[model samples]
Target: MEEKKIVSIEDRIPKLKEARKKKANRRLLFYLSIFFLLIAAIIYLQSPLSNIKHIEVTGNKIISDEEIIQLSGLSPETNIWVINHKQLKQSIEKNPLIKEIKVKRKLPQSVQIQISEHKIVGYVKSELEYHPVLESGMIINKHNISNKGDGPLLINFDDEEYLKRMAKELGEIPDHIFNLISEISWEPTEKNKYKVVLYMNDGFIVHATLRNFASKMKTYPSIIAQLDEGEKGIVHMGVGTYFEKLEK
Candidate 1:
């Protein structure tokens, strides 16, 4: 019985050694895998592959891509993982022309910037330059007047308050009616301080008050259609709608 017990003990010892050897091999493999993964991560982070390779700008018309990129403070040197999205968005939106902006990261290589710009309603003349006026009643003081095609011109508007209100009113008008107006001149009287004179593209003058100008101008197309062919006159739209024939 003693001899049999000794042989049984001997058999268990070899089995335990095999189990310990297998466990050690697994642990070594796990450590080696982690080390290799760390090395690969470090290599990728230091390489240009982790840098921003493409910067795409969309939904920009008046503000060019170069302008937007310059404002964002983003470049090919910017790392993909370290992008400050909020700072970038706030920077781009500082321009009066930009209403809102969205910044997005396309992992590994690219970033995209999308922007919504304020609608440019008209141009306000300042000295020899024509500055763009936005729908939000803000005027951009850019000097390059030839960058955009001509639209309605705001003339003789000295009061900033009235000018802002007029810009908002013009923006609210439908495009068809807005396009017909060639110029808007502020001509206030003692009784009506908000009076404005609009020169139409169709060779007619419009007398209107800024109070309900957009609502009243909706009927302009129909009124002009009722006039005689080649007729020239001043259309009164403030108190009531009527056409006064111009003296030949």
Candidate 2:
């Protein structure tokens, strides 16, 4: 500056007051905003908007959605924020069919539950009604004749111990090979109590034992591949793998 200009107190006072006024207004607006936000949050939490309005269940086949939801202990009135996901999952898993469950909360008031059921590897006929045999070697009660499952049918399997063993063995078989099996009949003798006869979908009869059945049957596809097309025979899979053609 070329010269020092003395500012009057009155002139500087208005500018200082204007700055303080602006700062105070900003602080007031901030406090008001915070207060309104708190009020809105409280209102939202108290309103039904915070309640679970929608519940979706998926990945359930044998267990019905209604049954799954009922097992979850969740309803429209249940609050999404207060859900105990672990407890709900444990509750649904009490059913033997239910292997696993996942519970998740979707924002704004919805919940999703996913269920995984045990796989049915085969079916055992009991009194003309076939019951599903799970991969876990457990058999469930029969529902209806029409509901007889898609897997291979087990016949003449009266002993629970052997049936469990058979179910476990069947579980290890690959789906492609398992599909080829139409029926398995238990024909135990004094010499070999684990004897089983399998009727294949390709018109081949298989004579196998429960011992090492899964390991031996894994080669069934390859065995059938080497045979002539539309060939019907008895496949001996015990000590040695061979074929005996039927007299057509």
Candidate 3:
């Protein structure tokens, strides 16, 4: 029995073709894997599901989410990449009532908006409804009226700027001094010079004119310091700032 070795170009050619086919298949698989990975990374970065996936809001009272979204130009489909957050802030702050605002972005697609709303230091009485007076000297006739029962109520005048200035004074006077019975009247005594007449919530009267207002307000604590609770008389600050004490 003789062992025979077989050799033929036809047989070798088929083997060579099979090897080449296997190498080509492996390279194609490698290229496909790289392409799919690149696509996955891009989608992860740009997809709404992965970017800005959550939204939160805070510091909003009368302003609703819908109102904020409308004013901010933010929506469920807003693209986080191109959203100009600074511009959104400017638009939201356009409302006189909004004092401050802050926005933050989180990883994996989340956004949060924090807000600071204006406070009602006092109120302005309108025809049917009264609006909350902001500390910054703005009046809105739409907010629910709260009875701030006795610091100073401006009546018979429509001076928005003066009302805001007066509201700030309420914060200066101690609560105890404020409780001293009073109604504030905005009477246009002469021209642009608006004078304020104070009615003691009690029976005494305080004549307050709008001049160096904050300075005059500082005198109230010391001035009232001497007056008795029952000394019901008119304390005047209109001319040269003096109190006309009436005998009990």
Candidate 4:
């Protein structure tokens, strides 16, 4: 039988101490590495490396990209970490045309601004120029004499309340019928203060009131379709639905 060899406690002490020393060194090294990595990350975030290098603005029609960016109050020098997205959105929404705005950050150094603007419903004639009226009841003065699309040309609409009401009514109108309206005039009557005359692109004149304009105007296509194709006339829907052919 082979004799069993047992290591004495005194002999094993040096090896045990060496193992403990290695373990302690590994722990210290791991902590030091973690501390250095944290410091590096902090420095990187504060440095120009984290600055906004690119800015993109989209979904704007009336407001220019430059103007939207200016309104956002963000610049190339802005730090991504310190940017307040809520404040940015509020600042950009200050423009009445902007219905909603979104701000987002991309890794490295890029920012994006997405905007939703009120739809342009019509244009109010101001002297020789025409100002755009938005669905939100805001009139943009920047564009003059430049027609964006075929929308109703508002005439003699001086009352702000009436204009806003008209805008609200116009917004609810379907695109197919809304596009047919060529012009609108605020022709009020004692019976109905909200009465207005609409000149349609199809050569039919519409007499409607802003109070029930949207609901009444929705029936315009069907009413016009029933009329004689060659007969040019005035369709009355303000009080009731009827049509009268123009005298030849």
Of the candidates shown, which would achieve the greatest lDDT relative to the real structure?
A: 1
lDDT of 4 by residue, 97-205 (tens): 7898888888789998989878888998877987789887788886422226557888878898999999999999999888888899998878788989989888889
What is the C-alpha lDDT profile of model 2 across 57-105, one tens digit per residue? Answer: 9987777788888888998888788899889888888677778888888
Cα deviation at 126, candidate 3, in Å, is: 3.1
- Candidate 3 residues lying further than 4 Å off, grouped into runs, are 1-41, 51-54, 58-66, 116-121, 133-138, 142-152, 159-183, 190-192, 199-204, 229-231, 238-248
Per TM-score, what order, best first? 4, 1, 2, 3
Candidate 4 lDDT: 0.86
lDDT of each: 0.88, 0.86, 0.68, 0.86
Provide the global lDDT of candidate 2 against the true structure: 0.86
The per-candidate count of clashes, in order, stands at 0, 0, 9, 0
How well does candidate 1 score on lDDT at residue 237?
Answer: 96
TM-score of each: 0.81, 0.80, 0.59, 0.84
Q: Which is better, 1 or 4, measured by TM-score?
A: 4
Q: Evaluate model 4: give its TM-score.
A: 0.84
TM-score of model number 1 = 0.81
Overall local distance difference test of candidate 3: 0.68
